[model samples]
Target: MDGQPTADVVDQVKDIPIYRTSVERGHFPILEKPEIADGFPDNWMTPRLAAALAAGEAEFVLSTGTNHARMQIIRPPYFLLNSYYKLWSEHPDISATWEAGCQRVSLTTVLATEHVARVNAKKRGGEPEAVPPLDDRRLDARTLYLNLRLDPALWERDDVVRMLAEIRTAQQAHPRGWYHLDCSGYHLAHLVQKARAWGLWEDFPQPASIIHAYEYTPLNVRRHLREHFTCPVVDLFGSTELGYLYYSDRHGHYRPYLDEMSVELVPVAPGSRIHSLIVSSVRNPYMPLIRYRSGDCARTLDGSPDPEKISRFCGREKELLATPHGPVAQADLDDRIADASPRVFLHQLHVTAGEAVLHHTTFDGEPLDPRACAVLERELRGLTGLRSRIEHREHIPVGKSGKYAWLVQDR
Candidate 1:
């Protein structure tokens, strides 16, 4: 089909009330989350969708809200999981692992683990246990969830021991004693640091393949994982509403996996390099989103609004910091920090009174050298056109959603 909305896309959404005005006008506006949630399932429900729900083909779910407020969405049962498996089984770099029947062990936010446990508990008609059993945390026969804490940096000795044990169990269950690791990059880095410190690294099983799909991983965190694991450490970029869109190969180059979906990039501002991601996807049969603004932003290879040229999934549109130079994305600041010091782990930029202050923590819990701090300050000034200072911190807390906010204004 052509890049524009196809006849099938028009037919799929024409009956929905949210699209009726656009359908009649022959022009679809950028659909935002608020519009999508105003009437929700009722506005989206057509006879076909209604039948799908009744027949158990469609199910209701909430977005993970890592970047913004959680929104309700409908899709085919196990839609996201199926999308992940499709990528894993077909990815050129990791397909061999999938074919070998390597089980997946997920280590991410406690919220995710709790969500799975609660779902399993509901299926069994009981309250969610305080600490879910191994069986309860298993997403399927091939996948298991592990971390039960919000902030990985705050993980105690007991937490690290439990998660490492789970990983070992998952690895041993496979005939080849190999498992695919799925995690947020930060979480895995913290685990490695803690495991080594506690003298438990030897007991931890090395994964056959690693995918950090949960959030926008920092450059330093990626390097830390690479230093530890010999396996492919890939990053999968997409949202809860939309399954895996683009994935990084072993060499850290992103490749699109847009099947039955299309993307359009609109520049965030007049002269900004960052572009907002708008998606037209029919992948979810129950709810086809047309020209939906995904609240995510990216940068292209040549600063053009070409989706195929998207080089980096930079940051959330809502979190972008406006500057005299232009709009600064999380990845923009992260690139400078990573260049100045490889030790920089988690960082947040706070803009106040026309000055920018960067609070950061190092991987080894040591402060940056005076020279490195000077370099970072100069770089920040150049990027933001404001006086800048670097403050080394012992820790930076994660957000309520178990994610880090890179941009903080007046705080």
Candidate 2:
């Protein structure tokens, strides 16, 4: 659209750019000697990108990388605005729920743990046992893990019972559903289980389809909802790079936002065609990324990048747990335990850390017989490589950033 031809713009960035910008965005990571731009970091910003920036189009920046290796990605303002619109303003179901005056009762840990730390029990099962004593737990909202690990009996504790009563009072004051409960599938399951334990299963007002993102919405969670509530349980799929790319239909099956995203598949090994995702989105014009790796495995009916036909968007490749044979994806663990109970959604399995803890939460907060929890613990040990003493924790806070961390490493 500017002075340069499209071909010239495309050719200038024919190769990958070396990234040096701040991991958080805009803070440049490296200042090159300029004598040799060739040796710059990989995934660098190109001249074409600079031109687009000069033209006053790109606005929002998205980050891509592991916890340590983050990269800044800019996009046209319209892309994000539209994305938000489609999610809330345009979606009648969501908008209607919001307009009802629901306040965000986030189960997410925005800050680190705080004053109530000592109360946190030691993790007993899985490899690498860890006990984050109250002093170790962060106080800020960001660090508190959401109560994703639900033990049905947790509600029996006076504090939890009080919280439920408080929530119910707030709901009554608002009348039309006053609170919005946001969490992952696992988190919601814990909530449901907690509610059941209080003899409040039919009593507690259900949230507008508990927004379960940050992980695959295990099928059992959906079944749990359909069986328990009259409300729709939404499952959304996206990454930090792509934002929210796919969401469940009213029926709760994912429908791709193909109009906004372009998807590609890159082989995992050299020859084996089983590939993960590489996204090149026109969503953000400020920083138009070409063939951006999403680190997620996927499969489409036909050999195509068409987002609509993508049959599956499995767990992150990097997050896959190592097993004796090879690697085991999160879905594999989910499948093995799927039959354990639809009531169970939130789960964390740490191997050999403390004892070996398989902290789990179901929709109805009924405590599993210690024996059942033990069975799950043993199964998880065999699945992952770790011997552990099994026990249940009432609390497993989600990261305040609004994503759930499945695997926690202690030490």
246-332 per-residue lDDT for model 2 (tens digits) = 666657555766444556666555543245676655455444444456667665667454456766665766666655645555665
lDDT of each: 0.90, 0.51
TM-score of each: 0.97, 0.58
State how far residue 36 of model 1 sits from its true place (Å): 0.3
Which candidate number maximizes lDDT?
1
Show how many residue pairs clash in every candidate, following the order shown.
0, 74
Clashing pairs in 1: none
Which residues of candidate 2, in runs, are more than 4 Å off?
1-70, 76-81, 87-183, 186-210, 225-228, 267-274, 299-309, 343-345, 352-403, 408-411
Best by TM-score: 1
